[model samples]
Target chain A: MSSNFRLQITNLLIGMCRGTPGLTAELRELGYREQWITSGFPRDVAGRSHPVMVLASRETRHSLFVEVAPGPRIDSDRLLQYTGTTAVELRRGTNLSREQTETYGIAVFGLTEHRDTLRESIEESGVRAALLLCDAEGIRLDVNPFMQAALANIFRPLLPISWAGVPRWIPFDHESGPADIAAAVVPDVVARLLAGETRIDIAEVCREQVLWKLTTEAGKKRLRASVRGALAEAAGREMRKYFSVRGRFVEAATTSSDDGVPLEHRILRIVSRRQVQLLTRLGGDDRNAEDR
Target chain B: MIARSRHHLHDYLQGRMTGTSAGGTAEQPPPGDTEPIKTYLVEVRGNGVAGRDPDFSVVKTLRALVSEPYLKAGFPARVHPARERGLVTIEGRYRGGTPVSMYADCRDPRHWLIHTLAPGRTADWAIGRMAAVGTRLSRVSMPGQLLEKLAGLGLLEGLILSHDRRQFDEGGGYGAEGFMSMQLWGGQSGRILSMMSRERSLSDSVSLSRVHVRYWPDEDDRAASCLAEIDRDGRMVTRGTSYEGHLHLVKVFRRLYTRQIENLESHFRVRADGDAGKLVGRCLTIRPARPIGNSARFCDIAFSGTPPFRLWGVPAQTSGSFTRVRALDLDVGGALDCEVTPEFLRVFLLSGTSANSVVRFLTNLQHYFHSGVRLLDQDGQDVLEL
Candidate 1:
């Protein structure tokens, strides 16, 4: 999702958590583990609680949401320190600054990208797969990829935890499964794809229902070369764009005349192989052989 | 000889083997022709390729039948010389110690498909399907019994046994998915079923004794975990008020000074630009609280309960002249200042062991410093130190 949309939703969630009883109860029912910090230096938000949580909700298909509520109010410097698009820090000194009394905490947020398949989600989530702690909102709060992964495993069995307790007075009868796919195994298929792997079949990977989201908007997204540990044009272009266009760096790169064009597979193929001879020793050797 | 490639069904209709016709002509039979009589057979061929193993092919074909309502072009009904392919993997020792692989080539056709399509056998397979469709089917079935002998109808039956030990869906039977698993219970039951579905493909079937079927989703035999029943041992708790108790003034006041001595000294020096080492000497003091547990009635925090804090004469002291005592920024609101600082008192806290640092912090604070400072992590243990 775009940065703007991500910010709007995150703020909305935080506000709802604080103000709306129904939402808070729902979140708590969905297993939101919010730590209690009643007071701090000047205000509660400023002690920098960073209301962080790793949540997963099987609301639709299955979604994993990781939200780190950065300080509700923070200095510009702190915001810059954690400026990752996925890692957003709240800015301070708004109209609520007076009510906050210069004390506010910012929560950082990171959502695990779409796993789409149930089978894969059961296995891995990149932020330290073992420690991939997910909360109710399908949000994962694993800055450390290793920890995220470890936690993912520890919580895999927990995904199916339901609060509907069976009392002795009740007689039980129920159906086998939902009409639609309710839950799936983890180490989700999309995660495998990002980690340089193919799917069971194109048909399985691309289901009839649901939409596919691109990792980024600007370039050719799926880098087969990158997928297989080869040079990916998109990665280079993205890195180049990140450094040059964003940085104002002199990285011997040029924005193509073809702006507004999404990266295509053909272009990626060309870029992955575009300048091998000039950039590598192997390329130099091949060029020398050609010259000879 | 006619062919029916998936691309175009009519293109391969050579001479139209139209049985519902006016007794075999050029034009294919209309859908209406077989409305009541049901002339066509309904034999479920397990394999699509030649020489396919009858075991899984039969079961998988049954599963597909229940998986959908009608057959599509690629997976069709009634074809000649069945095209089921069975897989084989043989491992044998080679010269290099690596296993060599080879496959057994079979050119024979499956009996289930071709045998049922005999020219005279019309409506034979359909009646069998109609009968089996609604019964509980066990994968471990007697093949001859499975295909009830319809002497007058004249259709061939195969030994279709179910591999699944659990619920199997032969559409609907006594124990089959179609019959038994219509809807699931909610909350705990939902959780269990959802979890089961993820790991296994479950189904049910009717049985002679207990209905059974083959090719059910993997059955996850989950051994339920032992649940813990908790007993709240301590029903005693207080809120919104300070716990009051009597204590020796020295125990309360003396300890308050010593605990704050090191930190207070450092803050004094950092803000004052003074010799900090001479100011904040590690010191110890003692305070008591209402007793509980086998704990020494209190615990230590500042020295990490390790470098064991022990003291006698003075909690802390500097032998230098009292000529200059400078104050910097008010420490968490002058926590260092008290009636004890005539000789620059090094504050220390003597604590009886309480497991709760929060309780210990406040209890020790009441005796020593007479203030509640949330700066310390409930133990009066400073964050910067950790």
Candidate 2:
């Protein structure tokens, strides 16, 4: 059981990293080391060793473990194992501003207007949860207190629903709510998937936020089962154009038209070509701007 | 082209080319207070491809000058190409109803000096616009350490630092409550800095922004009293300084600025390491008072506040005591990832990220997040020697 899970995660890591050559090459030069755990790792319920990949930097002493499709029992054990020893989950914690939230809305709207890929991806995953109802309008977490708390804690910083200038987790029972209460959310998830240096995994995002806080095995199980496929499918739909999906991970598509040009150089090239064209037309033909 | 010589430059600065003044002589000193020169020194990246003669576009820069953002905030300017190559005259009227004229010398591909005879505020407005236009152009950043070194050259006149505490004061109401700006003027200014250096609490609380000083070059024929006011963003205002004196100071300032640029570039330089190329990546280590991993306050202050910095972060997979975030710099169109621990913060810059963007980030980090922040390269060397 452990080998199968480990193989699945190892394959996911290989596919994602290979797709993200720009990020991979850059990270390598910076002295960050990656270790893939294929043998003698921690075990789960069926006595299978946990499959994980760890990326760490020696200078900063920073390490992060990437796991594949973590279930509640093993997730809880891993949380207990790393409890206080420099292994903490990254928290969003009301970091998403209103303008950023609006950008997400725009991105989602553009995606929906251009193609029907998002709706199809969501339908194919068969994810039916209160969170799935989220759109450009706002988030809808119409569920019990426990489920709402689980959803809220799992996705902080991205979905910033606030009151009196402080982030608050609201349980909206009806569709028509206060403007601020119903303010946009779901699009932020799309934005997160689209705007990043490296590919992100749905299972990894879930493992990062869910395990650290949940202590009880029952709570972890319930939270894991609550909205499993919904979030993953939502990520798939939003990242359709900008990213290429490989299993559970979504990597940004590397365009070949630019022929390996770095993103910065590409932008500069466009602006520079435009500048030269404009200068020639403006009749400013004097040269000698180059050093040589 | 205007002859790239000391004599011609002297004539230009003294307004002798336009016949505005008779120019200064050794026996007769130049009119003080009446002929103060404000120079907006800009760093430019190549906008042209390989084998291009005019690597830095003048017409593109003209459009940037008359760009909507600049015109709305500052003034309406008309740009005319000079008879000399890589030179342009900008004539405009400031919003305050003052006629302003500036000479932009773009002879060098690496740097451009925009000189104006208008008020200090006029220079500020123009420089601010240039900074806001695009990533191709930027103000030469003189970090706090550079400012301190410049102060040591001669008598210190004034110092200004905007120590930001907004992250600590999260719930504090709006207005000037978020930051504390302090300015000091007098001789022996090092005394206050010495005190702060000794007191850990005071030293770590404030970040340096601007420094005003008066220094005389060692050359006997040089101007005796050269008054200079330099800020962190590389705008220098000079008064009672001759053309030679100005060039001397600029030479020194450029050397320091070049050193900083090289240091920042070294941090981002990409090189392969043996077989571990797959596992290794660059890391810029910053030691701040508080840990930034998973800190909402750090994100709000660093990414959300300014352009070229306006980015959004998504939580990266992590366990135990480490937190990683993946973010895209929307303004500069670059992507970067950050890892945080209790003692230090590590930033992993990818392609598309510029050294200038990193400088701006480090500068802002010193102001808003931690004033005593120190940058260390992957090998644990000081990138910015503060």
Candidate 3:
């Protein structure tokens, strides 16, 4: 299979933009204009050529090399190693985090870049090994505690999940009421995940909670009861976007409008028969562990 | 230079302060004495790297105690190996030409106990110096819950708590911060927690930064008591204590601290070798009261190197709210890859990484992210349990 190739742009960097699918929009928001320059094919240290897009940031006067590897495939080891070294060199020279250290800590964007018009429609059912990402609004299907669980499900779903995790108590921020502190920790989150307990109960956590400096005053009973009611309602409302809840326990939610499969089940069936053929021909590496 | 025994060390300090080596009871203070002698207990967590065993050698630990970081952070001192085994003297002069001397017993490989009889201001300064040294060496960190348990051991004298809900999300600008400190003499000490909780603003976000408790060494003898104030980061100031009383307090403090650190290490130890399909054994799930991912501060606080802790590569942020980066721990030169989300952060141990890095990450997260963040063990239990 022969394809048209561009010239190699050796100094065009790669680590600067690895996991950002919406780089163009993000750069614009950060006050940087992206201008694509016609460059040579990106060559690794070993001289193997790959597709590369070189964009110069107009405001910062710095160049960003984005590698849009098709089919979400991992590049060669030599090229991957080169990117690692380049990232190190950039961080050592100056500080980067302080500049972006406020407001929204980091924005979680989702996949499916078909906001406008699409040339080739990527079929959800046909495609295998999809990336599980997060979003702000709409149905929010989040895989917390362990983001790697999604990866593990995608690559090797049949393998038994042997690990468990400790309980984490998260305190809710109350805008009103007394100053006493109340926190909730979802018990058996890891065990539920391991056992594939899709319908999780988040109510017990809110009801049976750790409270500090709480007084059992007869007059304050109504206030205490109201606070507990508000907490349960808030938790259910916040989690409803991710799952289907009947009262306290939560059931799995479907992926999208067209597909009826649960997100968790869909993730497990990522690598299908059609995708296996494509993967074999392309010699895909098992670097699925590296999410970026 | 070094005092051979505990008694010898006390006498050495006595001579330095009094200028006379009289056989007096170093275990009790003189009556009507406005200037009461006290011992400052400084716990230094050892950096267990291969060759630089700071805990084993007095000279090595002293070298670390007076490193450049300490010097820059107001701990300008000269370290000399003491004559006693596992003992070193850190000597420095205050701005007013007041000479301060501290004898650090490095006998314990894990926790180095520093026995010093200095004035109040000098003692506080020395403790500040130890904190500076911890920035390069190892900082003693304990969860607020454990500190509360320790506070329960004796009558509460004082408590200092500071918490900021806006630090992690305010986009580098100031947000809602609450600081409540109380120094009570008798009755107020017991009800301080409840009294402070009355301030609805503090809520559950409060972190116990420092706690002062007065415990009697001999319960029968009321006069034989010490008011010990311990900071969350492992610095302690014990006033009105003899050399024996200080040692007795240190022993108890050491036991609790060791247990706390050990449990933390076991829980946060991220290893590459795990059974197939298992979630990484343990992870820090931070539920920030407010939503994260709006500002860039999260990356800086998580990736940017702070003094001794270094990161090899720049932390890469996905257009989506995610960060995948490798952190180079300068303490042990170990590398670990970390993935950051708006809610959770986990470290992947690469090579030569130590549990110290995990401890540092949790300790800093409290100050930078959320003080109420809980670290979960493999079995889904809180590791901060006393």
User: Per-prediction TM-score, please?
Assistant: 0.18, 0.55, 0.50
Instruction: Residues B1-386, candidate 2: write the lDDT tens digits.
Output: 12234345456565431234434433332222134777777776554445765524775666565665646456887776665667776767678576566777776655677776667776677666665533456676565767788777667887887776655455652546456678888875667866765786566657788888777666565445577887787777777645445556666777676677666655453222222213223456677766555454454445442443455443322223344444444433344555555566656554335565566667767776667777776455667673
Quick one: ranking by lDDT, best first? 2, 3, 1
Model 2 over residues A18-135: C-alpha lDDT tens digits? 2221122333333334443323223322332332344444433334344332221123343333222221221121122232222110001111121244334323434321121222
DockQ of each: 0.01, 0.04, 0.02
Candidate 2: lDDT of B380?
57
**Stretches of candidate 3 above 4 Å error?**
A1-292, B10-22, B25-56, B60-80, B120-136, B175-186, B194-201, B241-243, B272-281, B284-296, B306-313, B328-336, B348-356
TM-scores for chain B, in order?
A: 0.14, 0.81, 0.74
**How big is the positional error of residue B354 in model 3, measured in Å on the Cα after superposition?**
4.7
**Candidate 3 residue lDDT tens string, B1-386:** 33556567767544434434446533343221224344443444334455864535557656765665645356567877655566777776555455566677766665666656566676666655654522334556656666788788788887776655454445554544433333445537548666555555554555667778888768888866677777766667666534345556667777777666565455444432211211122443434444566423576555444432333333444335565454545333344556566665545443234555565566555555555566554233455662
Model 1 C-alpha lDDT per residue in residues A43-140, reported as the tens digit of each score: 22242322222232222111122333222222333233222212111113111122222222233342344322311332232221222222333344
TM-score of model 2 (CA atoms): 0.55
- RMSD (Å) of each candidate, 1 decimal: 33.7, 18.9, 24.4
**Best candidate according to lDDT:** 2
